[model samples]
Target chain A: MAPVKNGRYLFNEIPSGYPIPGQTTVYDESETIDLDTVPLNGGALVKLLVVSIDPYLRGRMRRAEAKSYNEPFKIGEPLMNWGVGLVLRSDSSSVKAGDHVYGYFKFQQYEIVDATRVLVLENKEGLPWSAYVGVAGMPGQTAYHAWKEFAEAKKGDTVFVTTGAGVVGATVVQLAKADGLKVIASAGSDDKVEFMKSIGVDVPFNYKTTKTAEVLEKEGPINVYWDNVGGESFEAAIEYAAKGARFIECGMISGYNTSEVYQVKNLMKIVTKQLHIHGFIVTDLMPKYNPEFYSSFVGRIGRGEIAYKEHLLVGLERAGEGILDVQSGRNFGKCVIVVGEDKA
Target chain B: MAPVKNGRYLFNEIPSGYPIPGQTTVYDESETIDLDTVPLNGGALVKLLVVSIDPYLRGRMRRAEAKSYNEPFKIGEPLMNWGVGLVLRSDSSSVKAGDHVYGYFKFQQYEIVDATRVLVLENKEGLPWSAYVGVAGMPGQTAYHAWKEFAEAKKGDTVFVTTGAGVVGATVVQLAKADGLKVIASAGSDDKVEFMKSIGVDVPFNYKTTKTAEVLEKEGPINVYWDNVGGESFEAAIEYAAKGARFIECGMISGYNTSEVYQVKNLMKIVTKQLHIHGFIVTDLMPKYNPEFYSSFVGRIGRGEIAYKEHLLVGLERAGEGILDVQSGRNFGKCVIVVGEDKA
Candidate 1:
């Protein structure tokens, strides 16, 4: 390969207020090139190919405590992030270079990771490497584990999921369909509605156009609400929740700019209907943060049991805007920054 | 002995706004009393001694599918409610005349419950009978279960509890104390503050005087928020919640009739902190709606291992106003309408 030069996009500056245009910074390969010598002390180098952009990253950019899942990115240093990668070099030899893997890493062209944090891929199978950064990664794990642990989803129950075509939400819709439930999802556009339908969401509504309450009144008293967007979506979920409903709070994309502070009319529902609304981080609920739960999911994608779609931005330079697009609900499916081809 | 009456406080007219004089139509005692027969079914017939006057009862008077814990009280009925009582007769022998019990009952002077719902007062040593309506009753169970199961408190953690001297809140403050944590509480009056302190709340702030945010900032970053009031109290809890905190949604007395809505800000605390805020009904979380838990608690109280207290208002004439006073945060302890006094 072209004598591996440098890294790419990372949390450059802690963002304040809304992300202004051109907030993300990237390094030219020539300027930040690593020395020809690898770390002999004990390190492995990986060439990151695909990095996932999720709505939660915006919260990480902010200077706040009480974060949901992963800790916030440090203010100045290159923002550490999550991605699918290919191992380019290794020192302690559990395996040689050129094996595929994925895990949390900095947004970079090439970087070193402690051997333990680097999960080596055994089989790419027929599934593209991108699936690791989307469906077969945290997205699928979060969806499956959340439903299994927090929510009680029986067959024939009406399911409501906001940001339905998102990484985790999309997986949840499919998982619910597999279990024989009626799925009603909310997305941002008409095209997304069609996209959701292809993947098993029976009724997908464009929340921007149709009011969630009016639709729920005609069709609902929904039994389960997998909330991806928090503000208006949470209000809708609380309004339509059936008696003994289960509200699984996944993320809050809609109210990222505003940690909503106001009164809720449905306060009585929590007691009257005896609703069980829970806010959880998937990793925390797991008995052990095991890859086994994800293995079957990966196998599904590898065997073509599920579809893994992605919004791939061409260069690491484009990731900043890609993150903005994903955060603002402009991009559909799993947003990924394709930093480089796995050409070792 | 006074003959039992079945007259009701009816919602003959829906209030256009906040409650005023004449909104409740109390049918005269002469209208519904059944004085002809002393005979009753076996294992039933309770002489109600204490009735709960929680603020959420106000919602039952309305005519909407507003979120609620108990179904709205039917308009023409005396209004089904929660109470502690003494059995007048019991042919089934599970309970005999003069035994104390607690469960769902009516607002009338006497009630005949089947064997299915009555919880017998088996252990009454250090604990008083009033605890059956207060700390050792439904309110106590609600506080204990919510704070334990949902909030997951541990030693040295900081907790914030609203409506601190109310029946449930007072118990929650002590239960949290028993677990070895610092508690910051909000109450309406200075006397209530002293009551909270007596019950183990470390810092009691009179909510009527001090701003909630100011109190939280001075003594916060709370690990658990036991909210006994939903309106602005719920909003402030979210703001003060610590990273990875658990917010326990207990009740909302603050917004009894103002706009029928509760608002909350600082919602981003959910994701950013990975918060596990749960809106729950204690009965559901406890298996069999509280058999072992309640009985074990009673055992504790009898052994002087637990100390529970309450506020009792004498006579049925003031029951309506007692309920209103409880809703207004005027009661210093558990709000119970006393229907009789033991002649002992």
Candidate 2:
């Protein structure tokens, strides 16, 4: 290796509107990879095999005055994000070199990282390795923990999910269904709706055409709404939500690109029905309570009690396309970048 | 005494828009008050004094076929609603005559009610009787229970209340204040802002001038948002709300009159922050769990540890003005009708 160096995609400038082509402004390719030999505290560096593209990342690229969950992507710094990787070398006791793990690496081929913010890809032989990046990964955990911890979902209860075709959403729909709740979802396209139905959503509505209020009225009432897409969908969910409902607002993807949002018509439904709407960060939920939740969830998936679809993209070079696809609702399931297959 | 019969304000026609001046017909002056003398089994006759004129009532009036908190107002019959009254008679032995109570009364002066759903109001003299209709009542309990039970508020937490000058918002501000939370409120007018400040809000902003997100950013993070005025206020609250914040949706007054509604930006904040925005109705909170809460609440009010303000419209004749004032932000506090004083 000729004088190893950091390889990362920097946020050149904030994107306007829906982050059109070249809006992310991926920087130059790295001259040398940030190898494991670097003086990182806990573990050796790893080469990123697959990176995840999420719609929420667009929010961080904007010029925010204060920091949110992870720091807002700095104007001139490489956009910090989550990824799956193969450890090239190890310095920590828990994880070893060549061990496939899911961690928050940079948007690059290789990253010098600490082991604290990582999972050892437990039950690796027990489940698909890529699953550690999909349903078994952050997206999977997001849906599972949110539905399990907050929504207070019970069997026979009705559960509605906004953006029900996305990674977190699809996962929520299946999990809620597995729990014996009648699951309903809102997707951007008719195709996504059909896809959602195939995966066990009792009803799937195209948010673009079907009015959220109309669907809720048709559906009558829902006990919990696992929100992955906010805005008009949220407002609609407010109107249709059952009495004493719980709204776990996981994301508001619908309002990310827009400057303003659609208001809810029957917001008072919360006070009158005794509904609980709470906002939380996955990172806060992850270490604090996700272990037992995800473990059981993964068990559900393994036992065929739940199901999901995977929308995969090939090559690290296709990372930009994957991100764009997610932002546009073109990716129905987990949009993952395939760098290479793990031989571990 | 004339032939006495039960009276009720019936929904004559669905309101296409705000009833055109005199389009809202009233049945205040009536002598045939009681519908029947013999209490039918499972039916109770309630003499209602104070009825809630909430913005949500407007949605229930729309001609569209849909299920709501209550069935939509029939084309020519009475609208069943929330109110406080004296139980004139009860067919069920579970309740006795002359019991102070509240329930879904017909929007009228009196009605031979079905007793099955009646909730007896016990020991209500500790606080202002009007509070049973406003704060310490539906609106007040709405604010307190949702904040305490759903939001799980803590001292030093920051709370954001929309429509802070309105009945529900006012109660939320006072109750959240008692809880030692830093409270910021959104008012439609400068006077309302001042009123909110006088009542107890740490800071009050005119929603028309200052934006919720901008002001919320300056006030520090919001732990909970009691939303009564939906639209821009709610959208901004989602963006500006702190991590792990709970948003209690109570009403959508801002766009209740218009065909068009305001849109929000940054809905993605909900997922990233993991926000819970719940829509509820107060009738569902377990009465068994609320006695202690009500007692402590009333004690605080009686001791002046918590003080409340009421906007009383002298008679039922001006009920429209009172309702309009309450809806339009003209009323400075909880709007009520002085039907009669409490006497055994």
Candidate 3:
């Protein structure tokens, strides 16, 4: 068989700050693979359907020696993240042809992968294929576990969630609202703030124009904080936290691309107000929470009780642009790239 | 009944930085009280025996309007803190003449206080009277509950503790050692570091002479951090914290007395490491933990399985100096003042 176009995105450089579009990560249509003749060797051949572009992927664009929870992206190789794909051929029992699967998928149209690396996805609820990589996926699980276990939230509690229009924060904001909490959320743009308001956020503000601390001081003594964009907002949360406030530190997107990271001045408030600031990665809790989250949240989302939003980028060629959109706060909701045709 | 000398310490000013020994807090012996026939309406007339001087008091020295976990000390009034006292006279059922008690007692030779405020101190282990205000009291409880509940510790875990020779840090160091942890403790003085070693600390360093971050980088990726002094050390702890590290924020004495507070730069580590930083007051957990702690620890101390230390300031005239000693890191152990003879 002649080598067919694979169309992959490669990690080109370790970013010093915000990744440069087309330079830090590059999409090369010239890359190809022989699907029919390539050696499977007890592995499965899969056609990538949807690839998730998330803020956390920015942390992976670092030197291999830099230590973190996730391994650094290998330069000149396909940059990977949570993705859903259609199993085209299988040499193992876990996944079969025509079955939809999800796992840490590379940014490419086709791949030969270990059968064990992919989990067969059963879309019995008949939701969008992209939803599996969005609300019903990593972001949803992160919001669910961190909010349920660490927020220690109660009815009538005032919750402040940063990055309110983003996938993780939007999920938490909705969860808090459903649990009868007063939700105050923030976003970089006015349109995102409007989206937050549409979803029943009690006080939604554009942090670009409004002072986070002023809003919190006037409308809060925040009982719980779902922090995604950690920086000045984090310091403000610390300053306005009520006694025994719970802080769920999911992401620090504001400081993710900057060398001159924000210095938190009010950390002393942690002692003065007896605050509880907890940081967690969703992967750690996924083994226990994924099934639970999917079981409960999928139906709610299907029935229109919980809303899920996405910013979709079509084709593998746009993968680099999608990630830059997410990193620079240009993308709204759960940013996803459609890499191949969704045959499912 | 003739008037008798009633020596007392009064709050004279709101300090800008470290409390000035005689100006911020003053000891006056010119006032007198009628001890023979003092009014005791549903209260008790008590003779102050030993009064505690702690770093946390620096927080209470603020203006009355500054909200914190504990109320600010009222200016022009007798400064108050945990004290052991002898009941001279009583008009309530809670206490009687000749009973030894402990409470938030005034810094004076004699005072008429609400009888319910003071609890009868039954020294079943035959410990020193001053021990009730030191290791067997609030500081000890702070160490015990914060360590047991929040540290999430296991055997052989490396633990870092700041202000290692102070009551809270010393107690936590001993507790971690007993739990089979590798204890790394820091203090301002070489003498205090030696004291930490004597109490079974595996790694004891004088933070003033040795760089805290350098030592932590060399010997640790700290699994549990019992933080008392929380400025530069707090930042260093965050930098060196292992994945899933637990930070027990009992006090921020480093920032308590100053307007120029330290800015923490490495809070991003909280996310990358999935850390849990919990700040709690000993008062909040006392109901559940105090009895449990006393039952286990008092016996341990009595049997010589645990050791206790004290820095005794003789006479009521030295109360101001004692507090300054605590604030400035001059106190080697639990700072306490001998206000009157232990008539028990």
TM-score of chain B of each: 0.87, 0.85, 0.97
**For residues A254-329, what per-residue lDDT tens digits would candidate 3 score against the true structure?**
8889888787877778887888888999889888777777778777877778786899999887888898899999
- Per-model lDDT: 0.72, 0.71, 0.88
Model 1: per-residue Cα lDDT over B1-344, one tens digit each: 55555543444454544444345535336544343355666647777777776766677777766435556666666656677777767666778777777777777776667866777776545555667766777777887777767767789999998888777777778788888989999888998888777777888989989998888988988998887777677667777777678777766666665665645565555555556656776667667546765667667766766555566777765666666667666666677777666421
Could you give the C-alpha RMSD of every candidate to the true structure, in order shown?
A: 3.8, 4.8, 1.4
- Residue by residue across A33-85, what tens digits does model 1's lDDT show? 44356563577777788887777677677565644456767654555566877
Against the true structure, candidate 2 has what lDDT? Answer: 0.71
Of the two candidates 2 and 3, the one with more favorable TM-score, higher being better, is 3
Candidate 1 vs 2: which has more DockQ: 2
Error of 3 at B296 (Å): 3.1
Give the lowest summed-lDDT range of ten residues in model 2 chain A: A28-37
Tens digits of per-residue lDDT for model 3, B1-344 = 68989998999999998888789988888899998787898899999999998888888888788787888889888999899999999999999999999999989999999999888987888888888898888888888888878987799899999888888888898899888999999999888888888999988999888999999999999999998888899999989999999999988888877778687777788988999999888889888898887788877776767777899989988888888888888888798998899772
Regions of candidate 3 where Cα sits further than 4 Å from its true position: none
| Among all candidates shown, the one with the greatest DockQ | 3
**lDDT by residue (tens digit), candidate 2, B112-135:** 666667677775456555777766
lDDT, candidate 2, residue B333?
Answer: 68
Q: Record all residue pairs in model 3 with backbone atoms less than 3 Å apart, i.e. clashing.
A: none
Angstrom error at residue A98, model 1: 2.4
